[model samples]
Target: MIKIDELREGFGSFWGSVSEGWDRLRHTAAGALTRFKPGEQTALPDRGQIDDPLHFPAQSWSMLGGDVFEDEQRLVVRIEAPGMEKDNFAIEISGDTLVVRGEKRFEGETTEGRWRVLQCAYGAFQRTVPLPAAVRGDEAKASYRNGVLKIDLPKVQPGKPTSVNIKVD
Candidate 1:
């Protein structure tokens, strides 16, 4: 027979593990999670207006998962941003941060009935990631495929220090 105290302890351990996982995720992906609201003119996105406004809320939130890697020659950033065209994305470097901005338009059924569940977020979103080293932003190249945006930026090489010798008086 299992004692009630033991059962309580087991449940507490499981919940503690779950709580720790959530805290770790929150810390690692602090700015990756974003909230997007409906545009001024449209309720949802560029297309796919919800037939019943009540079915969907005015705002929704989604997470953009990404990774930043650095090598001896260059730095690479890959972001998971589905449901968008290649033209929709705009990449820029502000200081030591890499900024990715885009809009994920909703293309739902035009003749649809009430949506059962609308969890996907729409509208414009921006995600910024800090870089480990200074990069040559002007020479950066980017591509989008398979719902992923990859950016390759060459690292800026440091100039050699110039030394001068003063004549002794």
Candidate 2:
């Protein structure tokens, strides 16, 4: 006679909530620390606007800005880099880390009155994205259109291994 085994309902999932909470806490700390590395001058943003949670680091993004998606062959990164020109931006990938850097400066003088409202961010900014996997660093391509920077990262193909039988060598 053959016997069937009952499934374990929630063995590992029991700790899922706790583990997820712990990861969020750790990710926040890591993001803060990494944003202040040596020689990397950065500004700590004040409490974000209540109306714009997307401007806050806690809810902004995963260093990749906006939406980042992946597929079997490519990783697509869409960054919100508004108020920038092609020459004012740069995309560089070193090892597993991809860095997007640029500066935005509002030029031109106007003599009307004192400033009443100025909210858009200006000055040097850098966003670093850690790739989901080691990509083909050489074949990465980027393009800027309609105030968005899109990066296409091709996945590196893993070579198959072959087993050879040896008689006597």
Candidate 3:
């Protein structure tokens, strides 16, 4: 017969292991974890006849990596978000952060059998990057090509200092 305290200890150890693994995965694959939600009907494969070999949950995370470069004149931001049209992306500057939101639509292939593995992530997602210096939001320029979104934001120029003359009383 096993003691009650020993059983409790065993369960605690099991939970601790699970929590530790999750923490490791989260840190190791930070860029590969883009939270997503179900979008239109065509956004995801037909779950009724599809099979997941990796046993991934219905709600899967995607990877949307980005980079920021700054110079004396302007700041440039580049984000990788494939499988989306140019009109689908919406860029905005909120305070000192640059927010990018878009939806990746799914274009179903002409196949007969059920899908065996679905690794690509679909649906609506938003990514934000913090800006180092103040920028001219109204003068921002953006372009998308070959699955990359690029934005150029001009930095705000400082005003000139004015000198004042004092008279002795």
Candidate 4:
């Protein structure tokens, strides 16, 4: 009788843990799916829209995913920008920061057929990437091919030190 009671209690505890884990897993999956829903429309910001200086807009609103790599000579930045033309992007360098701004327009036929799903995000996006070291902004080269934008920023050479003699304090 004691052995049977212990076995039954252990089984009950195991079943309870399994049930709790299943519930938690289900809720986590549901929460992830609810974050981005189909047929959701996100309007693009206007040209003159001013964002808060402290906090920038969310990356979901306008995102241009990319990768940055550096070699002994130059720093290369490659951004994946599909469904866009070369004229849509504007790349600039201010101080030690590199800025890439572009607008991705959504083109779809919504009048003829019933829309079931829409998941692609489109709008104006600005990405500011700071260079690891000083670069020659004027000599920066950019090229776009097959939906990828690549920018090559050459690293600036360290300036030669100059010694000055002070006669009087």
Candidate 5:
């Protein structure tokens, strides 16, 4: 037979009771209200928004691109670009998308008394964002302020889907 003192000492005083309370809390109204509870990872991306990123042409990188928001008048894109100038960046639009391409270049020369390291990439990066509908590419304006580049694109009305019905005798 297990003594109460031994049970308390080994179970951290009230572990079993706390575990039951946790299970109850997990199944409470808050948990039952929505079925989108936290779940374990079962497939690639885990986010469920996209499946198998390797199959897609675009690659998602946390250090590459960022969010895009739009308003009634215009669509805006803000990219986090550090240690780059406006001259090194270029923005262009093709079809219903906007493409940003830039190349990073850095060189350093140091003697024995000093050490230098070129940590930034020197190749090139291209990021393309698809628009909701259509945007005026010619009038799209971009500005680089601080370490962010903001692109303002003129927004256009979205197209409506037509309904189809069939009549049978």
Candidate 6:
């Protein structure tokens, strides 16, 4: 017999895969749109005209993607953050939420010709992921390597209730 927890897990996995696929498709479409005729112009602002380094246009931004899964004793989370260093990320677990925040700074490039296309996103981004089960935040471990951030959180074990005897007052 299939249990409810099993069904839930199956659905969660299915949805996560779908969401990741959709994000990839959207990014591909946006990149393709930037390769139009040079003479044809849109209302979008030129990268050179933007004075503020933090200003990221809506159409040019992309969010970080990740996956979460649990093993027998640990809950693991892996996030894709390409071109970022270890010091660039700030991760915290508050209550039942795991918050990952970071900024991908734009590296200025000096080229003789003007930029014809710019699709990479560079700015501050935050992603909050809810824990599937209770975990010990204090004992959590994290590591970043090869543009991927991996976190391992120890799962909390349920303990037996303790009964206290009351003395007559």
TM-score, cand. 5 vs. native: 0.51
Better of 2 and 5 by TM-score: 2
Model 1 Cα lDDT, one tens digit per residue, 35-136:
665654224532254454444445667888899877778888999998788998889999999999887777667674656456778877888989888989
Per-model TM against the reference: 0.78, 0.55, 0.71, 0.56, 0.51, 0.59
Residue pairs that clash (backbone atoms under 3 angstroms), model 1: none
Give the whole-model CA lDDT for all candidates, comma-separated. Answer: 0.80, 0.60, 0.80, 0.66, 0.59, 0.71
Clashes of 2: 0
Give the C-alpha miss distance for residue 70 in model 1, angstroms: 1.2
Model 1 earns a TM-score of 0.78
Which run of 10 residues does model 3 get worst, by summed lDDT?
155-164
Listed per candidate, the RMSD to the true structure in angstroms reads: 8.3, 10.9, 10.2, 14.1, 16.0, 14.3
lDDT value, candidate 2, whole model: 0.60
Candidate 1 deviant stretches above 4 angstroms: 40-57, 110-112, 158-169
lDDT of 6: 0.71
List candidate 6 segments past 4 Å from native. 1-46, 49-60, 158-169
lDDT of 4 at 89: 82
Residue 62 C-alpha lDDT in model 6: 64
Model 4 residue 63 distance off true place after TM-score fit, in angstroms:
4.4
Q: Write the per-residue lDDT of candidate 6 for residues 1-169, one digit (tens) a residue.
A: 9999999999999999999999998864442222111212223346685555664455344646678887668789998778778887899998888988776665555655554555666556667777877889899999999999999988886333235799999
lDDT for each residue of candidate 2 in 1-169, tens digit (9 for 90 to 100): 4333322335456578779988997775453222312122323233431244344332222232355577777777787776668787788888887788776544433553333344455556677777776678689888889888898988786333224798996
Candidate 1 clashes: the total is: 0
lDDT of 4: 0.66
